[model samples]
Target: MTGAEAEGVRLQKVLANAGVASRRVSEQLIVEGRVRVNGVVVTELGSRIDPENDLVDVDGTAVQLDQSKRYVMLNKPTGVVSSMKDDRGRPDLRRFTKDWDERLYNVGRLDAETSGLLVLTNDGGLAHVLAHPSFGVTKVYIAKVEGAVTPQTVQRLLRGVDLDDGSIAADKARLLSTSAEGGGSLIELTLHAGRNRIVRRMMAAVGHPVVELVRRQFGPLHLGTLPAGRARELTKVERGALLTLARQAAGDDTVVRDGGEDPHTDQEI
Candidate 1:
């Protein structure tokens, strides 16, 4: 065996263990020039790589080869706090995550009264990029608010509204429907979650206080049909999307687990 191969782990094994596929399929992918290491196509069957330092991608999507790094999506039900543990002793994230072996934490937060897509991961670097408002990562929310919302209200939301802290606006706002029974309106608003209770506050400022709110999307992730109170590990495609966004948000393509703990992990939406 060459010293280079001896010094590094087999590339196929790395890909397979990273959930690319089985060893045989990974070998096929490598031999077919479908895998790249550090920006170079590596087709040799005996190819090996420094798993920790080398960047790898398959079919143009960056692959996170660390086995310990986990990304999970939870459909957080209303009333559960966004932390691993709540100091107030309220329903917390632990109930949904207790079964996982790795310690996962929320990338950001949804208000206790709100529910929907929440990302939990052990990858601190990605969390930092995603949680910090400075990155301008946007979230989509469907808020059911009081009273019949008019076209004027939607236009106002799209234009901007002044709150006590500052002026805020939705990137997109559309009236979804109106409740005939309660005379409430369902409005979908997409905006950067840059402040505390921004959605509820914005709705209140528009004279349609939110009765219920649920986040439907965060960055590139969609809540989909995942049931409330259930959590699922992100699929390979989803992981790739997140890694892509993290790279864009952090302005670094080589973001890694050891990038450091995200201090803004608990930042609320």
Candidate 2:
């Protein structure tokens, strides 16, 4: 092997880049001696392998460097848990991803009662950026509340709401539609917070108590009419848009937007 090939990349980094797991988790796997190189168990953290020439395996599965990453958008249905597996026998996101052979995990989470766009991917780096609130990745939701959502309520939501966790504010909130007799209303809200049940908590804090909440868009990807409980691989254009969004959120000016706009407005839902 050439000197450059002999040097190779760090084993953990190779595993992470291959979407086996996050870098930290990959290190854990290495330390546990679950990773093998050239048919020998390797637990050294600094070990490196030429992915092209070295025989690397994790838990008996050959670690082949994937040229194509898998990115899936699932229109999760209510009552299904956003998990790969559930110990309590609850419906899980796995039901939609069973056909996929590549290892993937949900980017973020949707509670059992909430439904709509949930991104699942084998790209750990992108998933980390999208899930981190510091990235300011916007998530838009349409909330049907128990009370008539007035202009004042939208103003209140924009101004901020106090939850048990902390203060939270919506980037934008507007009434989409209201039921007759002024009993209930469908309101569109946009926010960057990733706190658990944040949308439901925010609406409840404003005395409007969410009756049904559906995420309409995540970053540049929209739920559209994808049908509930079904998953589809993201198109090349969609994947590029998501990566662009992640780069922009990370303050990486080197990457251009490529004419893809952030789906932050109510009209995009």
Candidate 3:
């Protein structure tokens, strides 16, 4: 091996570790000649870099490695898009994070009509792992449906529902409670899939269209009493748990490229 290759890590791995993108996407950047090392354009796939000594740039902009990772939990409110920006002038998640200076992206997604736990972070690698279905990071949602949810309906949800996109089964499905006044039912279900609008579509397909939806949990984080439209940094314990989950998932080769968008919010409601 060459001296540089022997002493340094692969360029793509370095970029992935630094949160530029997933390893696969980082390789694409390298191949496209958008990545440079120490002021020199380096397009060789097997190129290595001494992260501590070599300068890395993407598209002529310096790639700054964040020593401290940021993880945030937000209780998203209804009618707010899960994205950073919206062209139609609708309210977006950025308003909730305006106080924070860090450039953060949503880890997963909650549609504008669904309100609940949403994670925001600059840690692309962790986000990629958490969003990928293979990681088995469970997302818990409490859905209020139009009709009464019964054990039979719950069983059907557990069995799986076929949507136009594909068939999806909930990891766990149970009736949490029922509302007599509104003639609705509260059903809680957990799933590892990140397909766009899968929860809403699944319930709708099962003959109980979701009237309201809220994500109560995402992996190790919970939406415990955080006011709607407010966001807070992840506690050290929460952050550690998430990092550990991501690391374990990555070690198992369960991570899939996230493409830097909220996996669950890719489809419009």
Best by TM-score: 1
Give the TM-score comparing model 1 with the true structure, all chains together: 0.88
Off by over 4 Å in 3: 1-66, 179-182, 252-269
Model 1 lDDT tens row, 86-109 = 899999999998778988888888
The top-ranked prediction according to lDDT is 1
lDDT tens string, model 3, 141-219? 9988987777898999899888887788999998988766768999999999888888888988988889899999998
Between prediction 1 and prediction 3, the one with superior lDDT is 1
Can you write out model 2's per-residue Cα lDDT over 139-209, one digit (the tens) per residue?
99999899777788899899999889789999999899987786799999998888878888888898888
* lDDT value, candidate 3, whole model: 0.78
Query: Could you tell me how far off, in angstroms, the CA of residue 103 lies in candidate 3 after the best superposition?
Result: 0.6
Clashes of each: 0, 0, 0
**Sort by lDDT, best first: what order?**
1, 3, 2
- Overall local distance difference test of candidate 2: 0.77
lDDT scores of the candidates, listed in order: 0.85, 0.77, 0.78
Q: Candidate 3 — which pairs collide?
A: none
Report the Cα lDDT for residue 237, model 2.
57
